[model samples]
Target: MHNYTIAELVKGLQSKQFSSVELTQHFLARIRQFNDQYNAVITVTEDQALQVAQLADQRLATGSAPALCGVPLLHKDIFCTKGVRTSCGSKMLDNFIPPYNATVVENFEQTGAVMLGKTNMDEFAMGSSNETSFYGPVKNPWATDCVPGGSSGGSAAAVAGRLAPGATATDTGGSIRQPAALCGISGLKPTYGRVSRWGMIAFASSLDQAGPMARTAEDCALLLNCMASFDDKDSTCVDREVPDYSASLNKPVKGLRIGIPKEYFSEGLHPGTEAAVKKALTDLEAQGVELVEISLPNSDLSVPAYYVIAPAEASANLSRFDGVKYGYRCENPKDLQDMYCRTRSEGFGEEVQRRILIGTYCLSAGYYDAYYGKAQQVRQLIEQDFVKAFADVDLIVGPTCPSPAFKFGAKGDDPVAMYLEDIYTIATNLAGLPGMSVPCGMVEGKPVGLQIIGNYFDEARMLNLAHQFQQVTDWHTQAPEGIL
Candidate 1:
């Protein structure tokens, strides 16, 4: 059961090969057995999951169940799961249980997917590595000493470790895709506004978008079918018809032109990862995909621009967490001023504080024009670069991360090095385009991900390309040795 992909699990449940209760129990047991090795899950709702599974079994009997009925999945701690501690891997909100579910959680609930637990994340989704998580770092299943990418690292680890078949993760500058690359799984980041963001704890308001993480592209497509919808409550959500993402996943890839950016293959990329991406491209070419070399010259400026824009928004969004609010509050403060300063200083982790400080400074009146305004202009240049390249390409492909999973603390001392881990991924978010990561090959015993970026509202096409590639490769089928 643990080895089954989400597509297989759906079939088994529909055919009554196993009851949802039994399936839920199987996953709960797996989490208990394997989660300690990775620190992937922060909380387990064993009783709630079993109860939900029982209801799903009843619906299955009626033959009117939804696509995800009885499926068990994890939610990144950043999403508000009503009645569950929605800790964003920060001590500040450690005791906060959202009174209402995040729009993403509600959608999954409506589809009858049982929530087994909430996974850990970087404090307020602020770090590149899971080390900033208050719950502790998530160990890469491929190498226990290596760090799984973050702040979706726990969700990535949980799925990679086979504790769950899929999970819900958000990408604010590559959180979902980077971890998926390092942990060896399939993950997607839908176009901004394609998925509702209401109740999802804001990191960088403009860059944050939720999507699916699973073992196979087909599974991610199925999950996305349930996760996406237009909600009036989320002002950012686009009003568009929700397509069945799994419906077109078997589409032919011939005649499709994919762009390869010169910047992606430049210095700093690991040789093994480059070799793996090239091999994957060759395989795609054999399937008749036209590869075209293109230039995204502004790609070099993405890191600097993202750091400015993302932190600026984060500073404004996180201001609601002052001591007087619902989260952590300082005790026995001398005055209101003391309470405000002490509560924030003590509650937030070092990484979160660093980002907050940077954000505040960037948004300050004196530096606003030089930093934030200039970054916005650079962001526009990045978006224009993608727009120009897309004229001749159906999609853009590259290494999801510059390298495979690295030993914990390898880049901890250098913020710039850690920020560069997302070099190939941040542009898509800046451009509001859909992007996904699929395991391409192994590098030093760890996995490398091939990223596919598509035009806005073109997720079905992206998933189709990924599913077709998966049909020819076994990389996504492989799991960490000795971990299982």
Candidate 2:
């Protein structure tokens, strides 16, 4: 049951091979067995999960239930869950419980998917590795000593470890894809505004887009069908028709043109990762897909531009947590000013503070034009580069991370190196395009991911391409040993 993909699980539940309660219990037991090793989960709502599973079983008995009627999944702690502590992996909101569900959570609920728990993440979704998490870093399932990439590391680790078939994750920069690459799973980031951001804790509001992490592209497609919906509560959400993402998984990809950017293969990429991505491309070519070499010259400037723009947005979004209005407050404050200073100083983790300060500095009156305004101009160039490339190519392919998962603390002291970990992924976010990471091959026994970037609102097409590639390769099917 734990090993079954969401698609397979749905079939089993409908066939009466197992009850929803039985499936939910299997995952709950797995969480208890292995969660201590990775610290992947923050809170387990076992009682609520079982109750939902029981209701799903009742619905299943009637022979008329949703496709994901009983699937169990983990929600990244960044999402607000009604009655459940919605800690955004920060001490500030550690005790904060929302009275309502995030739109993503509500969508899953409507599909009758049981929420097993909330997964750990980088505090305020501000780090490239999960180490910045207030709950502690999430260890890679493949190699316990290595770090799982973040801020979606917990969700990636959970799916890769088979603790859950799928989990909700957000990608602000490379949060979803990098971790999925490191942990050997499939993760996707929908086009900005394609999914509602309402009730999701903001990191870099403009760059943050929630998607799914799962063991297979088909499972991700199934999850996306439920996750992507426009909501009135979120002004940024696009009021477009939500398509059936799973409907195109079996589409033919014989003549699809895939672009490989010259910039992605330049300096700072690891040799092993490059070899793996090349091999994946060769395999795709053999399957009748056409590979075209392209140039995204502005890609080199993505990291610098992202650092400026993301933090600027984060600085404004996080100001709402200044020791008042329902979060952690400092004790024995000297006065209002002292309370504000002390509460923030203590509540936020170091990484979160670092970003806030950088953000504040960039948005400051004197520096706004020189820093924030300039970065936005660079961001426009990055988006234009993608727009030009997509004119001749259906998709863009590259390595998800510069290298495989690194050991914990290897680059923790160097923030620039940490930021570069997202070098290949940040541009997609800057352009507001949909992207996905699928397991390509292994590097020194750790997995590498092949990133697929598509045009705006082309999530279904990207998922189709990933599904076709996955059908011929067994990389996405492999799992870390000893977990079971």
Candidate 3:
């Protein structure tokens, strides 16, 4: 029962094989039993979950429900959940109980998907490692000593640990894909406007995108189909139609062109991780998909460019939390300026503060063109690289992360070292392309992910490729010992 996939769970609930309350109880119990060790979930919504489960049972009885009806999934703390603490893993919003739900939350609620709880994440979604989270780092369940990639660390850990079948995650510079890779789960970062960002706390508006994290690509497709849509409130959201992601799951990949970027295979990629990813690519080739070596010359600049651009946008977007607004405020202050400084200094974590400072420096006069403006130009070059590559191939393939999950404090003191874990995933976000990390195989007893990057809005094709790969390989289903 605990190992059931989203598809199986939905079918089980509809067939009355288990009540929604029963399924929710199972997951909530799992959270209680295991989450304390990993610190995956920041808050569990038991009362709301049970209440929603009861409503789902009634809806199931009435034979009227959305596709994900009765499904249990965790919400990343970055998303605002009404009446639930949407902390974004920061002390600033730690006390923030939103009066309204994020669009993603509302979408799942309308579909009868029960929210199990809010999972932990890096503060303001700023760091590649989950250690930046004020609530504490989420441990990789595959190996308790290793770190779970972040800022979507908790979302990945929750799904990978089987605390939830699926969870929502937001990516800004590989937050979704990087963590999923390290945790051995499946995650997708759709095109920029694929999911509404209305109630999702901003961490880099241009790069931020809400996506699904699950154990399988088909499950991700099911959740994403329900999550993706156009929203008028988000001006950046395109007025494009959302396709049926699940419908493409069984699509054959025979004769499909898979591009292997030469730059991605360059030095700095751990040999074991590269070997596993290459083996996965070979497996795809043997299954009839064609593999072509391609190049994205500007790829190496992604990390540096992302640091400038993302932080600049984040600093601008984060200006709303000025203590006068709804977030955390100082207990006592002499004046307005004192209040602002004390509140922010106490509320923000080290990484968030570092980023805010960097952003402000870059966006300030004299440095704007040298830093932020140049980064945006480089961003265009990065986008063009993908456009050029996609012109010849159906999708691009690479190692999701350079290495498996590292020890908790392995890169703790070195921010740049931690940032490099996202070398491959960040380019896709910068280019505004859709990318996914699918469990491919393990390296050094820990999982290594194969990243599938698609052209903008080519998520359906990406899902098809991942689903086909997962169908043949058991990697997606392989859990850590005792997880089942």
Clashes of each: 0, 0, 0
lDDT of 2 by residue, 254-356 (tens): 9999999999998889999999999999999988999999999999899999999999999899999988788899999999999998999999988889888
Full-model lDDT, candidate 1: 0.94
lDDT of each: 0.94, 0.94, 0.92
As for candidate 1, its clashing pairs are none
- In the range 1-484, model 1's lDDT, one tens digit per residue, is 9899999999999999999999999999999998989999999999999999999999999998998999999999999988999989999999899999999999999989999999988889887789998888999899999998988999999999999999999999999999999999999999999899999999998999999999999999999999899999999999999998888988899999999999999999999999999999999999999999999999999999999999899989988888785889989999988988889999998888888899999999899999999999999999999989989899999999999999998998899899999999999999899999999999889999999999889999999999999999999999898644
Error of 3 at 200 (Å): 0.3
Ranking by lDDT: 2, 1, 3
Against the correct fold, how does model 2 do in TM-score? 0.99
Higher-scoring candidate on lDDT, 2 or 3? 2
Local lDDT at 376 for model 1: 95
Each model's TM-score, in the order given? Answer: 0.99, 0.99, 0.99
RMSD of 3: 0.8
